[model samples]
Target: MTARRDELAAFLRAARERVRPEDVGLPALGRRRTPGLRRQEVAELAAVSIDWYVRLEQGRVGTPGSAVLDGIAAALLLSPAERVHLHLIARGEAPPQPHVPAPLSGSLRALLNGMPLLPAYVMDFRFDILACNAAASALFGPEFGHGRLSNTARMLFLEPEARETNLDWAAFSREMVGNLRVNQARHPDDPHLAELIAELRAASAEFAAWWDDQHVHERSRGTKRFRHATAGTLTVAYDMLAALDGSDQRLFVLTLADEPSERALRTLVTAHATALANAV
Candidate 1:
């Protein structure tokens, strides 16, 4: 519990440091000793007393009310996901127990196989790639080899190749970090998630910056752009399908919109399939 308190305090401090005084309408009066807004300043902005805020930051109290958490979130300029994480940590429910990895049943694989024109893949709650069709593999890159794969969020933040392939790297990076922020709130204690966060913080400055912002994003249909070395620029629509069972597995499918993009997609799929077939 003390450890959890300390962790929360550190997370709060990191979050605070990223937001400038000017960002929250505070006067940037000359130089400052601290990297971020002072405790009193935060208290003032949050409409709380210096003493109470100090106590919370010091981890003197076990839990804070939602109202108090809300104030702190506002003071820190936390994003929606970050606010949720703050509340979860305050209530000592940030970290969740690890569950067994759900298997990708044959039926699910069959369904993906049937979607010939669409690039499809299955992922666990942690974004671990369970299974992906040839089209999906082609969309990501040829470098993404088979077998036990790393989580998509981890790869996006840490892998140089993924960063290079992303058409709008900054936007995609923020979205990945924001999604991770939400996942952290939902399963804070997952060791895999913790490790991935630590690894990302070490690997990419951009990732570290976004992670500190405390942004959150819900899983939903969206458009993503990729710069395929062979296919040029390709835009695809993505959707997440939740598993019927109680497990947290989700199926992500990507499809092209028009003729040029569709042709590019077909080329990619054909190339990937040929490569895989030759390997087999």
Candidate 2:
């Protein structure tokens, strides 16, 4: 038991050491000989006292409750996998798995593809793009239509072009992170989700920091502006439609709010069709 507690302590220390002050929205102080975040800084962020955190690092504290563990995990900017590991070590039990996204139905695929004018797509709980319409394909471009690039969250953070295409890049990215956090809370044991989170954390410092904020969001509806390469600026309102079929999958439909945006979307769709015809 003591050995296990010691292992936990070491893990905590290592986790803390990997997160820098600026990563969590904290201003970088004077140069320190040590790397990563200081224990006091972590305590302050986690809303725990310096003494408790010190004892935790020293392996002198007992098993922390879920709330305290979650707070610490947030402060240390632990990934989903790391958070699950922390919970297991602290609670000595396996955590419950969140509902995994089921495969897209044929009807759903047909429905999404049928919408030629509107940019429509089906996304799973994790924001993986299962299928997209011609308009969506044209609007998002090739990067989003390919295999691994089909994941919207991954593309938003990892793809450099996404930063340029998204009008309000910072706000949009932060909201996406918040939505992912909501899913992470529900499905802590999901390996793919864990892997996705790890990749995002490694790829984007902004994602790493925003995730630590522990904001939760569910997508009902939102407005977005995009600068399509061929279409110029297009503003669209998106509605997330929940399927009545008991699955967690959602069909997202984007509609142009104004005449100019509608014209832009039409132009993109026409150009896309022309390119496809030329390719064939």
Candidate 3:
């Protein structure tokens, strides 16, 4: 515990030293002995007492709450990843993960549209749909639109239609749960993810049971079966491509592997287009 506190204090000091006063809109005071912002300045930015900040910096303070940590992070101008690390070190627990979606580049959108025959979509770290091509919208239905309804994990677990849409419901649910577990382990402090897991556990008994198994899996590329409302059963091969940007976004493309599946996909896409045109 003492060692942990020492490490936390040192980390806080280093983070404070890296931040400049001008960066946080503070005037540059002439001739400071230290390179970075002073402890008092950091405390003021965080809206905490100087003594309290001093105790925290000297390894005399106990684990702070989320609000205090958040303030410190802001004071230090910590990046998302750094903020998470700070919480872990100080509290020995994961902090809340904010939902800051990275922007989708036009090139990625063009790439998705380029594959007219395939159903492709982009997902953030939380499996939230960021963007999708026309084929994906056709395949997954209109609920696949961006927003709460489009979250892949939420749709799979909470949405009643998923049980009917996924042909192999048991296998598919297990794989999705396992993949989520892997991500949870990778980023335990993410608040949004924790909330998602809690919601799933409360909503689905099957999800709760699967989560208990502590299974971890990373689903990059594989074969998945779906029962389309109009097109019927189809088996497709999928490939998950990682984005070059450091946003932890992945692009998933599903291609029809067989003639029957190809026919179904084409029919689905055509019907979707017709319905959209009629609606417009």
Q: What tens digits encode model 2's per-residue C-alpha lDDT throughout 141-256?
A: 75565786888898889888888988978887898888887876766555466556655764578887887677777767888898877768888898989888977788989999
> Who is ahead in TM-score, 2 or 3?
2
lDDT at 2, model 3: 80
Give the C-alpha lDDT of model 2: 0.79
Enumerate residue pairs that collide in model 2. Answer: 98-187
Task: Give each model a TM-score.
Answer: 0.63, 0.68, 0.65
Highest lDDT, which number? Answer: 3
Between candidates 1 and 3, the TM-score winner: 3
Span of 10 residues, lowest total lDDT, candidate 3: 186-195
Candidate 2 error regions (>4 Å): 11-56, 59-89, 94-99, 145-148, 157-160, 170-174, 188-217
RMSD of each: 9.0, 5.1, 13.6
- Where model 3 places Cα greater than 4 Å from the true spot, the runs are 1-99, 277-280
Candidate 1, residue 226: lDDT: 80
Cα displacement (angstroms), candidate 1, residue 145, comes to 5.8
Segments of candidate 1 deviating more than 4 angstroms: 1-97, 142-149, 278-280
What lDDT does the true structure give each of the candidates?
A: 0.73, 0.79, 0.80
